[model samples]
Target: MKKILTAGAFMTAFFASSAALAACETDVKKDDITAEQATELYECIKEKMREGYGSADAPFSKEYQAWKVTATAPAAPGAHGKRFLITYANETAHGEYVKFSEERADNPMPVGSILAKESFGVTKKGAVKAGPLFVMEKVAKGSADEFGNWVYSAVQPKGKVMKIKQGFCHGCHAAFEDQDALGYPVEEVRLKP
Candidate 1:
């Protein structure tokens, strides 16, 4: 009886753990996102962005550091000719970036990929001014290049969505249709281990 009870308890615990892991929505959705998921995603990245720009109370400062800096010196809206930095959130995205030149149209960022363009300005005194944070998330499967699939949003440093538009970003990036609507020249990204 004791053996049977122990086995039953172990099985129950295993199943419960599996269910909890499955509930984690790391993979981006193919179509529209649930309000809850959108909120969570926004909040998570927003918090990270806050810390990346130096927020004392922010969590996950080290976590954001793992993100690959794919591009720097890219032109941005309000950078005032200073430059911009682009970072990818995961290995899958970085892999796509590393192979994009060779694979061309064949390779694209996976579902969970998130790209952030951290716009910053340089002062004469060599101080850095953090600008708007632009984020692009690649949704799985479908690719009409809109908010539902490839979402685009610009966020302020304090976690405000300055803008969330699809056609504006998609239309410009769509010119690079071979690279899955990506704008940055990832061929220059020095892939780190």
Candidate 2:
């Protein structure tokens, strides 16, 4: 019995370390920071975060009541995959959302608009497990190098950044220049009032 228990413990430790090392394995950008490192930075901040980027505490849960889904087909025919649900902070986005359609990609949002996007994985059982929350808030001006003035950050359910490719986010959002990088399906946006 003792021998079996010792071997089990050893196996568990080895696998845990292997997983940690593998977590940092990924392509790096010019900055030399791997997706793992960036995710680590994100997770670290999320762990201690008390508020959204430009908003008060618990913006999604407390402040925003409903989330507007922006996927081409939120109910995709798959057991597991990626999907997006979005929400806006101010009335400007809501106004645009109320009348916007996927065909109308020219709806521009004003500054000071905050968008909270919930990104999660779908289980093979069609259940929702813990996932990341992506937050983007439009600012007065963006750095010359960024996609737009909108600041982007992602946080996991436990509060950490999920690993992703460099420019993995803005690269897609860039297509919506007229909409200030809100690449969601316009027709999918919704709010109570």
Candidate 3:
């Protein structure tokens, strides 16, 4: 009886630990994110943005870093609903190159710019019920002119000037009316320092 009780206690403890760890792990490749992890990433970006701008006192500059993960819905007729994970940072911008490992030697995608792969709906909070998959790169750099303005641009490797499709942010937010319409993750917004 004593040995049996000890084994049962060990099993309970092991299961509890496993459950806790599972809750903390984020399956980004699967596009499954918990509200807690989403909130943590959101706040990190917000704080970094505030730091880069010195003060929140003027017309807000557009310098920021961000990423989004989207999962698509099933192809069946009425299916709908998707999830999105977006992370952003603000600071003095510098452009980075991007390169894909499988590309041919002649391929022109840069060497290090941050790469983003997004699916439309793998989690309950995602943006699309199911459909498009997007891959984008983000680069931050000071402006070319004398003013030395700041800029953050997301684009495809095929073309340098093509703008990213960030506009979908608004629509996704509207769906989760309780959350920020822009996928801002309100719970993570840090208080101004």
Candidate 4:
């Protein structure tokens, strides 16, 4: 009886720990989640996303974390499938991108500028799932005129390059013509220059 009871206790502990490791969930609704809660969810899953994206051997996927963050926390505005998004700008882009300007005149992202946006979704039950890493790279003028000279691509959460249609991404970006085809983060979360 003593041995049986010990075995049962071990099994109980094992299952409990496993449950804790299975998923990072929240009690709040997805839209109702606060910056603090979003941050907590980010901290819980950042490493997993990094590892998954890093496996692709892409510079943007592996090096984005070292870039300057554009927002204080992940934000949502019904874009990117309504997933929460956090953006990072590489050295070539940080100076100009940080301006967060709204006018396109005299405010184009420079060639070589690369912006990487990391995304994640919260299920109805608030179970956090890592999403893809979307990348936008600016090239020389006329290099990609139809898409504002910006090349769009993505890496799946598991490190596979996603099939991207330039027009598909540019179609939505075109709405932000005044902003040079850029979508700034929600005002409240943007880091001040």
Models, CA RMSD each? 16.3, 12.9, 16.8, 4.6
Q: Which stretches of candidate 4 lie over 4 Å from their true place?
A: 1-23, 57-59
Where does candidate 2 clash, by residue pair?
43-160, 43-161
Return the lDDT, model 2, position 171: 82
Each candidate structure's TM-score, on Cα atoms with residue i matched to residue i, is 0.54, 0.49, 0.24, 0.87
RMSD after Cα superposition, model 4: 4.6
- Residue-level lDDT of model 2, residues 23-60, one tens digit each, is 43334331344334434433333322323322333334
Residue-level lDDT of model 4, residues 27-78, one tens digit each, is 7898898998888888779989889998986657888878989999998778
Worst 10 residues of 3 by lDDT: 92-101
Candidate numbers, best lDDT first, in rank order: 4, 1, 2, 3
- Best prediction by lDDT: 4
Per residue, candidate 1 scores C-alpha lDDT tens digits across 22-45 of: 433345431233335433333334
**141, model 3: CA deviation in Å?**
8.6
Q: Which clashing pairs does model 4 show?
A: none
lDDT of every predicted structure (CA atoms): 0.53, 0.47, 0.30, 0.88
lDDT of 3 at 37: 54
Q: Write the per-residue lDDT of candidate 3 for residues 1-193, one digit (tens) a residue.
A: 4555588899998998776545433455333454555443333333433343323222222222243212121111111233333333222211212111233224322323222322123343322222222222322233222111112233221222334334443233245333211122223322222
Backbone collision count in every prediction? 0, 2, 27, 0
User: lDDT score, residue 148, model 1?
Assistant: 38
User: Which of the predicted structures, 1 or 2, would earn the higher lDDT when compared with the native?
Assistant: 1
Query: Best TM-score goes to which candidate?
Result: 4
Greater-lDDT candidate between 1 and 4: 4
